[model samples]
Target: MDAAWLNPEEWTCSEGVQEVLLESRKSSTRLTYLAKWTRFSRWASERGISPLRSSIEAVLDYLLHLRNQGLAYSSIRVHLAAISAFHLLIQGQMVFSHDMMVRFLKGLERLFPQDLLKDFLYKREKGELLIQKSKRLKNNLLKQMQLSVSKDGFVHFGDTVMLLSPENNKSPTENYPAACGNLTLAVNPDDITVHTSESLQVPCGLSAVKSVNPVGRNAFRILSVEGNSMGEPIRFGQNFGLGATGGFTDQMLYLASDHKSFMRFAKKSYLQQVFLTDELSYLTCWQATFLDPQLRLEYEGFPVPANTKVLITHCHTNRGLAVPRNYWIRSYFGKEYEVICHTYLDSHKAEEDKNYWIIVTANPSDDGITMFDRPKPPSEETREREKNELYAGT
Candidate 1:
């Protein structure tokens, strides 16, 4: 009966909570609260729970979800506080006012008794957190970070930045602990079949011969697909002087060629979560990897990139091209990422084996790949294909 209950502000993160966030914001509590609230909304939507009408029961379900996701205990308590605060802002009362909420959190404290106030950090399901401190703590942490970097080239800042769920979070190797970015994948080096038969075209109208082979049709798709961050525009199918065509540059072509040589490119796993701490220079290697953003590769039933696309043909053995290849697409962000496909979960590394992901922040490495300039005449095959295509269009 009260129109006040129908107000949109009752369910949104707006002015109502703005002052509260500022008033009680801690080292990074403001960001933590905002992020946790966002995660809450996302979790609610996925399960068909309405923000405006979600009940205490739903709050419990979310907590269970976070626990099932391996979030740290302290992180969970913070999230619990965030949820309670959010509800107070929107609903004008606490859905979690029940003593059980307090009791549950207290119980968790008994189990995971890590001191949140003293512990430098804790990781989360998605983003990372660097709790700023009273200049003293901040300087000490930075010194520690710098020391680690000097010793290890770069340190996987560990166990502090907390995410709501690993299923929903995917950061790169850098944000994790010392064990991330393990170069050796599950594939046996002996199983890596090398094919010395194909040629990879580069932008300079020249080609590089690759070693790995795929039995699948070498049907290539170089159409350059732009992503969130658009670098230099890679023209499709044009000889840009040693770059890839159709967005497929020499690096991509080389990887695809390797896939064909390996007999079944799918058998060998390429590098994932690569991070060279000392090198400021970077390059992204687009090994011929493909992903189905939804069906098999969905993260929490949502596509990881949510913009995954693929192109392939039904010709060739598909083996030469590698039927089910799983290589880390090192080109997306600077971090190497093995696309998580439902179909390949069994073959993927154990949770600890792979890097603790939070999305990539570093640029790609180019030690084994190349992208460039300098003109050369297009191959006769390219010229002929264009000629034939022009005539066919007419």
Candidate 2:
């Protein structure tokens, strides 16, 4: 075989074809293609192989070599384009169209989930995609309506409502809903009752708490082991549980003590995920502490008011829950951010705004339930009236 195939300058192309090829692409692109083609030619020559008659196995090896050299998925595609163009010019063959080559590229994409282009692509499994869409639809329906409340005139224990951020409420013109955090927390085991693992902790799904809307996964039913507080006001510093409002699994927010589960940035603090365990241990409890951004202690031990900013710190770690704005993860719903529990200083140092959350009640009118209203049982007069009415009907 003539070594002419190893060099673009020695290609046995006619003058007319060469002129037409020059007109087909910009000078910059032609130069880039030629440069990339030269690299491949040199690799083939080192092995004493013909570049024009390269097999699928040979091309795969070359692509893998590029990947091993730290070339991104997009960069690999550029090399393929150059090789494909030059190979067609000389051999009139489509090396890139081979089934194996196509599959190899797809495999590369999956192997590197952090690829820049993967952000805009749908990388979730088919079943997960459907589940995400269904969850989104359910959230939309919830947003169209109000939350479920109790009769205590405040968001009582066990009331289900969406946790909205007060950050957007400060500026009417800003679109903060797009940056709202939604829990991607899930149960550790699908069936927690039958599971026998003691170290089983609830783990956050591939997606964190980041969400575009403040409903569905954002809705949670306030719970507590204190059954006496069921109809009472949800007070501050009280250990409570948060069960995700909509889902087949009983996913409740829990702070995993396992060192392996801590956030990468804040290693001392735990990453906030969901637990599916039926046990009401301290791990699943969190406290709505009264540390206001303004440095006020006026609301300590008071009922958690609606639309009022409050700090939610994990009871186990005493670290405040936060969502790092810069760190993001791709999900079936879209790009989402990670939610973590950070050490005291990391959570509240000058950036405490990220730690502030509002408990939005589902009540339509503000007069119906005010946080100032102290929860009380029915009065004796009202009880007597009810008794008389029952006797009269008998």
Candidate 3:
């Protein structure tokens, strides 16, 4: 018969063939069959034959062509299975009988015996070795990201600035006076000198003594209070910064936390005017009617909220964290203060007279210890009062 006489549309129009095609459409198996049918049709057209009238000899020849193209044996098997299913639908029985299908499958198995055996063995293995190795590498990276603070007011681990309060561990007498005095600030791994102080000690922690030479310049500094006065877990000696700076930015990039928390400074009047509420965290943008009020800023996103308090801890780069590059603020709160910014850190040191800040240190290497946000625990009296109210049903 002239194979061209057997039209594909005619074959599809057959009662049982249409039903079989419809059933296949609802499954992945049907999709595979349709793809194989397309390839078979193309091959038939090249031979001037209708695919429907093509003999088993033609199918075998197509399979040989696939083998010569170096396709995986498993892929070839899927192609054969798809073609055989179509044959069964048209013939009303297994077109390649069960015995013939088995022989074809056996031939594929022989073609790539080692690969097939390896695939089988890999599936049987209790755990995926590659996955386990990947997990281990991730864990190691997390460990490397953890920030470490030392007792001597040195902050280490990632790019970080240590903001120390004299009150952290010292008596009132040990605290530095608010008045101007000689102070030391340090820079690290290179230990490059910036300033010299006659009164302050040299090689102090990770910082060196720097003399504030306010020559032909109006240098103004301000002290600020930080942390939740509502009695959160902020402890003494915790390192904090005023704004994002270079070194600290590098540290943050390495830490790679899912979220970041920082206190920002706002104009004093604005802070007083804005309504304070728990849900304020959800605000994307708001205008403050008040002026010059210091606002406490906690940034979960960036540009760190206009005029908010900023901690000088190293945050990993937003780029490394998959955040936008411009997220870090160069200047904020109408202040020209520099905030430490980086992907990693070594050691951090805090200057007690500078500002009070806190650090919430987390070990990224630790498993099953993700940071969580919850309401502060109620006081004992508050808890008892709540219990009493519940019992009274009022």
Candidate 4:
């Protein structure tokens, strides 16, 4: 970026100090770029393709080739940046600035992630493309992690973790796994329990090795978890099961207050099954136990999570971290209910409030749409009344 390094092609012998500095920078920059450019050239030539004048697909194929070689994210960035610089050297600008190219680079960061939280767009079973929304919180950049890039470059997005971990960002260099807000942790009964503060969403991994079906446009498999023998439809069931009972329920709407014992575990320092959070926007309106605020006299319907869940297992060990946050609230129609537990494994996080909704009843109306009441926290006066009542009763 320096003026002296601008003309990286300048190869010269100099006697003066400034001249020597300029030459050294030029040589170093040129050498570094030349090596990367040559690699691309050789790669293209081997495949009988052009490097600089290549099409977007060609360039993407080259990137995929590098990715298949197990390149680190930083290293891959350097390669692409080098290509951009190469084009700038000849064309006085960049070749990788197209919208498709930009998306390709952006997709690389998520498709090939440095941590647990990932984002990308994938085509669903019905041919609808869904974009997964993921946030890179501050916790992502502060962990001590050692990444193992396998030669196959195949990352497992199906891991379900129960991290009852504290929000400790003090150690930036500890050998730990990168934390994402949502993850698909393996719920094995034999694995040792790990307690961390991060509960990442790991949606279903659709592969030929495992069961896969084209259902929702979301990025996960719909596992129908039930309460009182309720279940949701899966791709396999929808396509194969003519009258299967496990595949007919909805994945978005949750039954509130079905599990009343959630509050008992909420207060424990270690037990964190039902988390009390004020961040309602993390999920769709229908996914919340209370009424959704987005509903209006002007608007037509409510929103829902891309994925949803209705039940979870309460355990004392590491499995507790995998439990979804449960909430009990009153609907606008004056009905009291609790939203079902939406664990990280449930694809509900991917469910959008647009068009789709969670129908919590077995026999919903012709239209499963309904209005909800706005939610409000308990007032100070109410808290005082409860406190006084508790003292008086004691």
How well does candidate 2 match the true structure, expressed as C-alpha RMSD?
A: 18.2
Ranking by TM-score: 2, 3, 1, 4
lDDT of 3 by residue, 1-394 (tens): 2122233554546666666545533467666677887897888799886666566667777877887787666667777766665553334434455555467668877766875766656744844444443343233222322223223331222322222211234444554322222221221111121121111122111211222221101111111123323212222123222211112222211111112234322222111111111111212111111111133232222221111122333222221101111122221112122212222211443222233222222223344121111134699999999999999996
The models' CA-based lDDT, in order, is 0.33, 0.57, 0.34, 0.33
Off by over 4 Å in 4: 1-26, 88-93, 115-394
**Candidate 1: where are CA atoms >4 Å away?**
1-29, 89-97, 111-394
For this target, which candidate reaches the highest TM-score against the unseen true structure? 2
Judged by whole-model lDDT over C-alpha atoms, candidate 3 comes out at 0.34
Listed in order, each prediction's TM-score against the native is 0.25, 0.43, 0.26, 0.24
Error of 3 at 253 (Å): 41
Among these predictions, the greatest lDDT belongs to 2
Q: Which lDDT value does model 4 have at 118?
A: 19
The digit string of per-residue lDDT tens for model 2 on 319-339 reads 666654445555434555555
TM-score of 2: 0.43
